[model samples]
Target: MRYLMFRLAHISDPHLGPLPEATAWQLANKRIFGYVNWRRNRKGVLTTDTLDNLITDMQEQHPDHLAVTGDLVNLALPAEIANAKRWLTTLGSPEDVSVIPGNHDAYVPNARMKAEEAWRPFMSGDIAHSGPLTFPYLRVREKVAIIGVNSARATLPLLATGYFRKSQAKKLAKLLDECKEKGLFRVVMIHHPPLKRSTHWHKRLIGGSRFRKTLAKHGAELVLHGHTHLLTKDSTEGPNGRIPVICVPSASQGFGNSHKPAARFNLFDIDGEAGNWSCRLIERGYSSEDKLISELGNQMLSIPNG
Candidate 1:
């Protein structure tokens, strides 16, 4: 029997653009601050051209699935959300892409809801879900079980925090167990890092302890997130052992400064079976010298046997 490896591509914080025109009412709340910040700080840095090039290269790799961790829009404006749907479609079909909401997607009250309505196809599970979409949704592909948890929510000005409720914790625990029972490679995707102290206090995941507790109890093969817009590799306690948590830079960032890095994405090759699984992570992004995307490095991720 031939063992076919699954190629999964991970990209986050695209912040997809050409910021649509917004009315005064749309900018009245937290969006006002985001609008100003985008205009002054991010407008020049995050560009669709950069994302296009990066995605073009990613498509050349012919990944089996794509995981978008979020921040597909800048202001969460209606037009921006609609455009993001089109962008996702151009990137891949709904069956091949899975998305979770980011803080920016919920920049203001009900903004995340709008995103849900527009991007439901990409975010929904394989099974039919009644009413509104729920977090910790499950999508099993081949031998991999992809679980999506939404941590994004509307916040006050200057706040980019994420939240993981007890409700989600319960559902996630159940999902993790179900996946494990099936002998599947469980991969959890969340917008915010679940590891404590992984991000600053103001921009941290509020219920990270609860999230971590759930993982510690239930266990998972890997966790993927994107919010810091910087490459990060961290791990947390799991029932079996330390579970690897990974993050990538903003997918739309055109160039890197001393502080913020350039656009990048990860390609994960998942293979093996229960109790003896294997995964290799390949980092690909802009080469500062030529200002072109290329393979940066690769590593074999530690997979704790459950």
Candidate 2:
């Protein structure tokens, strides 16, 4: 029997809102550098227009399954989570999509509960709660296995970090081992990159080294994440060689004056037999006359086995 190939659309860091006028003002007044960065890098501070454009572009791609890595809101406000839920509904049914919480989604003390309440409507199955296994759980398709993990949780005031508790790490190890034995094409998803070198102190995912060791042991075909809000790629060196880890920029971020193209999402096509995969970065923009533009293209890579 021939395994059916599945197409996955991966996007992250939309940072949706219940952004109050005051929040905008605070960003402008106190966080001047962050505000300037947002203006220069992201698309106009969370406008409905940005969401509309993203939804439109994603619809055009017609992904079989959608994976959102995290950071669905700027602040973990109940209302913001509600807004994110609505946006997710518009994208596709929750049954067709999988999402993990990001640092911003769990910013508040009751962040996880709030996210559960807001996001449960779109979640297809049970929320993984048994250690890191609560995430890193599997979504089995005809020929693909989508593994998701939760890396976002509330942290101290000074530290804006992501972490996977020890229990979760152990659970992830078991899950990977079991899935690999099944001969499935695995797509592992986390809000933070599995590699420590890809992150800095303030934004690092605590216990990242331990996590990487587990991932290296189990082996995954693809690893996707979105916490840094910048485009990056790293490889986890394994006994077999290297496994590709791909990070996408913020879906709602703008092109800015950096001359980079507007925000984009990735479409991945997996070959069942050859165990090969191809990806395209699809950019979303507006025409000079203010119409939406969809550009499908390839990104160059220099990795040895990527």
Candidate 3:
């Protein structure tokens, strides 16, 4: 029997707006200032045109599933979330896409406590909470399993910390075990990195070390995240094998700087019977008329790690 295969497009940290005035001011004073310096030195470019090009390219690729890791909004405002929902709708049906919340998504003081109430309309599966952690939820497909977790919550400005909560971690273990028994290719998604080194001190996932341990035990095939706004990759040795953790760059990085203008997204293809997988990075550029264009990069990875 020839098992089914699927193509998945992974993108993260779009940071849509309704950007708050305070945040906008910070970006202008700090990020924009740096951006101007870089541009003056002919180092980078910042523009929304990159995002437009990315969207157009993704539409053409037409992956079987789209996984948006997080930070769809800059300020966690209702208007911003609504705008993000509209963007997702334009991509495809809600069923074809899966999303999770980032720290910015939980703008209100108790946003984590009320995530389901605030963002349930955009999500497509059961999301009832079990204690403080509501996760290990499943998005089942004919060829793969998408497991999502909630790692975003309001934090003190000084701390800027994120947590998965103990209950959620334990639930994730059980979900992974079950999925493994069923022989499903599991793709775990979260806004925060499961490994500590993937983030810095102030912005780290508070329980990341423990989360990594859980994933190592359960054996996730691929782990996807955002939050750092830069392209990065790491791997962890797990009971089943080595699991690749891929971090995507910010889609809006071009907004403040023109020098570092390479904005990109990822495309993944998985074949079940052959146990083969391929991924490529697609970047956005512009034409002389200022129209957006996509430039495809070399294959990032081919699975079975030959």
Candidate 4:
């Protein structure tokens, strides 16, 4: 049997904006907070020119697939959702892209429903079965399986937490098992980190414990997420071994202090067999001073041939 190398470009938290035109009624709710933040501080930290440069750079790399872990829209406004859909078209065809929603994508209770409808093509599985979109959506790209989980949900004002529903949790384990049997490189992508302490208290994933349990039970090659908006590396247990969970900074983060790094994305060059994988991670980010996007970090991750 021959193994082929697969390159996946992972990006998160684009939070695309300029806050599309919306009615006052739309801004009367939770969106008000998001809109105010966007106008006051976020707008400065996140610039369209910076984001465009980052995307252009990623396109230059031309990975086999692009896995975006959500927050395409900040307020989940109807217009914002529409804007994100158009943005998705630019990312690539549904077959070349997979996406999951973030807390901002479901800023309001009903906003999640609207988001599902708008991003259905990108989140739906290859099998194509369903009236409504469902989580643990597995997109098989040749030698890789990109499984997207929906951690985005509506919450009270000031809360940015995500939730992995009991139902989604159950399906996630089974999805991992199926992927394992196929011997494909499984990359679990979500908006929130599945590990505890990976985020602020108010922004953590609600069912992280259960999510962790599922992963330890079934296992996956790698996990990618983006809710924290910073580059972080950590790991948790897996059935056969340890699973690497990486979080990259906002793809639109222009520049900032230690807390806020500039726009960045993760590129994984993967190959080899189960338990003996040779994966090279290249962390790429924008350089405002140089007006270019360049490699920021690199690591050789090997799954010891145990």
Candidate 5:
């Protein structure tokens, strides 16, 4: 660990939209379905007011770094992608923020390519290495090695699943080992949860078993993800002990009804050294009745000493 203390803020599944008006041509493909879903359900559920307020509060926290774990766009429309990039600029500069894509980011076949190009800066590592920007990409900030993995993929309509490729899994294991050698706090950021039971059959990660096996072989201090759009806290076996896997509700949602969750995000205050560290997770959100954003929970946790 290099820093005496570090503050990291995490938010996810913004699903940001008020979809840009489209021609019949634009909605010709699978987007036709997405358009209906957005207008009929998401339009009311994910409000810009809530998203703006959440972002305003997040900025006020002034965390050392911010991690947005994907679904930045809704329809993967050309305009939607452009708008999301602009929104990211408002959130923070590439130097202060990092992002990984969710399934929605790659909603259509060609959308993945566009997203990779549009969001490359946020996804790139500090030390530019060889090859295309690949999964298990590492950004070392102070003591934290924020590793980002790509799980987003274009799927058939009504299938919201993700896939963690075997090639990526192999690389991830090596990256985790590297972190252990450097004594950096390893935080794995993926759009989909690595746990098998994390999501429904239709939305689950396709190769989650392999991902978990990689973790069991290597190790990480923490795992943060979204996708499920619910507040989830569970544990998985690490080389040394149990590793905490946490998820927060969608960033743009209002306090949920039956179908959606409210807006929420997490601030992790991290400190201490390699093999001896302390991290306190502070969860904040705007509840259905709350007049303002406030802390919902706080818990002190320790990373297993390597």
Candidate 6:
């Protein structure tokens, strides 16, 4: 069978709207800052309307798979988590979509566990043998091997950091080698950018150096992430070549506020066999000039390390 190109749509940080009502207890912790931030600044910027428009445009493109990087909810409230479940179904079936968590999804000490319980299906691997789903999970789609890594963890007030555990790095190395031996294109998904200098001090990916060390040793075709809420294109060193590391803008960002780009999603067209694959990135999102969502641009991505 001649395998055709696999089109994967990537979006992140929806920060889904109309945060659930919270009592004093719920807002007493770090959530208070997030809550205040949401009410004062984010309420106007992160809108479901923008997210709906972006998703509508993305669905119209007919991607073979969808990858959501994280932050589906703000404050990680039970109601917010439940609402995210409903919003996810509207995106596609669990089988058609793969998701990871972001810092906001783990806004509290117990929030990450709650998110895991709620968004289990979207975070599961291909083979279902599990008591608890683990990170660096594997999902195969035709010629591609999707590796979902967990870097999300609750942080102190005013910090939006993520952590990549050493254990996950070891497992990720093994998975990379296994996928390489199988002749599958490896795509690693995480909530924060793997590059060390990708974000500010407060929002950097903790253990990013270790994450890059693993990729340098084993190599991968592509890396997708979302946290800085900016449209970014950068590369990290791989064993044989450079691996493309990409991050998209928030899926629900409006036009006026913030220095970040307006809401956008990318469609990556991946093709070719293991050693000689090709990929292209087509970006579509809102334009601040006219506040209209349209095809922003496209670029041919670098191939995987040999």
The residue pairs that clash in candidate 1, if any, are: none
Off by over 4 Å in 2: 21-46, 121-133, 256-261, 274-292, 299-306
Task: State candidate 3's TM-score.
Answer: 0.79
Clashing residue pairs, backbone N/CA/C < 3 A, model 2? 128-134, 132-168, 136-148, 136-149
Any runs in candidate 4 off by more than 4 Å, and if so which? 256-258, 288-291, 304-306
Model 5 residue 249 lDDT score = 92
How many steric clashes between backbone atoms does each model show?
0, 4, 11, 0, 0, 0
Tell me the whole-model lDDT of each prediction, alpha carbons only.
0.92, 0.68, 0.66, 0.86, 0.88, 0.92
Each model's TM-score, in the order given?
0.98, 0.81, 0.79, 0.96, 0.96, 0.98
Q: What are the per-residue Cα lDDT tens digits for candidate 6 across 121-157?
A: 9999898766777989999999999999999998999
Q: After superposition, how far is residue 94 of candidate 5 from its true place, in Å?
A: 0.4
Position 209, candidate 6: lDDT: 95
lDDT of 2 by residue, 87-114 (tens): 8887888778888888878775776768
Per-model root-mean-square deviation over C-alphas: 1.1, 4.7, 5.4, 1.5, 1.5, 1.0
Any idea how many clashes model 4 has?
0
**Model 6 bad stretches (over 4 Å):** none
What stretches of model 1 exceed 4 Å from their correct place? none
- For 1-306, candidate 4 gives per-residue lDDT tens digits of 557888999999998978787788988988888888888878767778878888999999889899999899889888889989999999899999898989998999888889889889999998898688878888888878899999988999999999887899899988888978887788899899888788789999998998888988888888999988888888888877888898988988876544687899889998887656778999888765785788888997744333
Worst 10 residues of 1 by lDDT: 252-261
Model 1, 39-112: lDDT tens digits are 88888789888999999999999999999998999999999998999999998899999999999999889999
Candidate 5 structure quality by residue, lDDT tens digits, 129-156: 6556778788999998999999999999
Determine which window of 10 residues in candidate 3 has minimal summed lDDT: 29-38
Any idea what lDDT model 6 has?
0.92
Q: Residue 295's C-alpha lDDT in candidate 4? A: 85
